[model samples]
Target: MAEWDIRKLQILRTLRDRGTVTATAEALHMTPSAVSQQLTNLSRQLGVELLQAHGRRVRLTDAARLVLRHAEAVFEQLERADAELAAHARGDAGEVRVGAFSTAVSALVVPAVTTLRNTHPAITVRVREAEAQEAYELLQAGEVDLALSLAAHAPTAADPRFTRVPLLADPLDVALPQDHPLASAEEPRLADLAAEPWIYGSSGPWSDITRAACEAAGFRPHQAHAAAGWTAILAMVEAGMGVALVPRMAAVPRDGVVMRELRADRPARHVVAAVRTGAGEGGAVGRVLEALRRAAGAPAHEPPLPGPARPPGCPVGG
Candidate 1:
């Protein structure tokens, strides 16, 4: 009989990726000595020489590679077991920690929570505001049960660690001052606004998306001001500072800001819900996923509904 410490195996895997104990320690937020100690313990437990000194660096012994192969299998099985237990432990009633961008929290998560309140009243949803990239990190760290993220930044469909659920195709509309010239156009081509000043974040997915949309339209946006908040961006547009590409979910109806569609163009960000591999297949996570779909006006992906609540109308992400 043998006892295996999964944490030790994970450390070894990190070392394999980083190619050095110091690098692995940095990645895992541990001291290099601590990493060495853990691996030493693991080697003693398995009675194997997992590492061998190379020229000034260490290399994994053949035994280490073999252990890694089995370790991957063990990790997968553990994930599956976790999913099963998650489903079994919380059929429809449990706390679900959800991470999402601010806009998504308003437009999707809150509405879903309301729906779940009426349908699965016992389900408690704890919402954490996290952007697309950060949400993935939160989900990976097991700090969040579900993550609502922008599909543009979410991990690839082939990533085996997460199960992605497509939730919405949120279109972007050109936000301009109500008094701007193009404001009166029923639909303005993005090219028409090429000379206009633009409001965008200094750097981030929001900025990348806006710039990409502009480039696709054959002109670079003249970023006149940097603002990450939709509220700030829209306010700037209202004050005649600049214009911006505001996602439909985040384009709140401000009195001084008018949102206009770009003729013959639909630049949209895909919104998705992600869970740890198989966790979204059932249980509290599944119920929340279904509610989010309905909230986003998308068809429910799972048939876990007991009743329905009205979807709340609110602004959402970039």
Candidate 2:
């Protein structure tokens, strides 16, 4: 078998997924005719019927299917090689693609990226804000070098396919309007505002943390609103829409909102930095991981501490 171009493998993958030349063309940003021509050329090169016509549609032949299975693995290996080579050429000049959960992106990721830029200027960092499971899939697919993930509960098993590094354990903080009375309190408890309407961030580890904290305080919070993004939830809080319990990271900054530590015994969710097994051990990913370690404030020999309480412009206390 002749060596296949990575671009052809990508096209094959797209064809396998999109199932139509038109859809695959759109995905690959090429004209339909162009995609068809490439497929024809690829088939001729392989000397096999890679695709077959079924009515107006097309489908992969059995031989194509077998080729595709191996193609995927080969393409992945090629991608890693390309990434590693790029990392080498620039003298640590590779790129680190990272997927992060909402809160992690808002708080630790931004600052960590800032540090990464200052330290390793040659390395490129591509970040995607994603949910935990989505990030995990991206990591598994080799689409991203690291995934910043969170769980309301512990993960099922520490699988050998990846390495999980605990970055931070951020507690749930209460978000109140700046004028709210409890906003200034050194520490507040869910019991303090049992009757107030609340904004919730739907269901997640962060939301679960809030619910459990409130339940431990002896009342079910009146769920006034539910949203996915912290900014939306915080914006509602800013408008005095309702008080909300969010991860400490969400409370980090933004005008017109106040975040205070919850005195309740429930601890915060753990934020994890996951890599594709050995994917991030060196090169650009390693540099970014180092910055993440610094931004998250986890020193090698020292115990972790809660990150600085928000940035300067974003007031926390009332």
Indicate which candidate wins on TM-score.
1
lDDT of 2 by residue, 1-318 (tens): 755666776687678867899988876789999988888888778888888889999998998888777775665455456556766777777778899877677677788878767777777888898777778767755688888876432133433345566666666677899999898886777798899988876675445656666777888888889886677888999999899877676665768998777665444666667765445555687677777877778874232222222221111110
Q: Against the hidden true structure, what lDDT does model 1 obtain?
A: 0.81
lDDT of 1 by residue, 95-123 (tens): 88999988899999999999999999988
Distance from true position, residue 148, model 2, in Å?
1.3
Candidate 1 scores a C-alpha RMSD against the true structure in Å of 5.8
* RMSD to truth, every model: 5.8, 8.1
In candidate 1, the residue pairs with backbone N, CA or C atoms under 3 Å apart (3 or more residues apart, or in different chains) clash, namely 249-316, 250-316
Off by over 4 Å in 1: 1-4, 13-32, 43-70, 302-318
- The lDDT leader among the candidates is 1
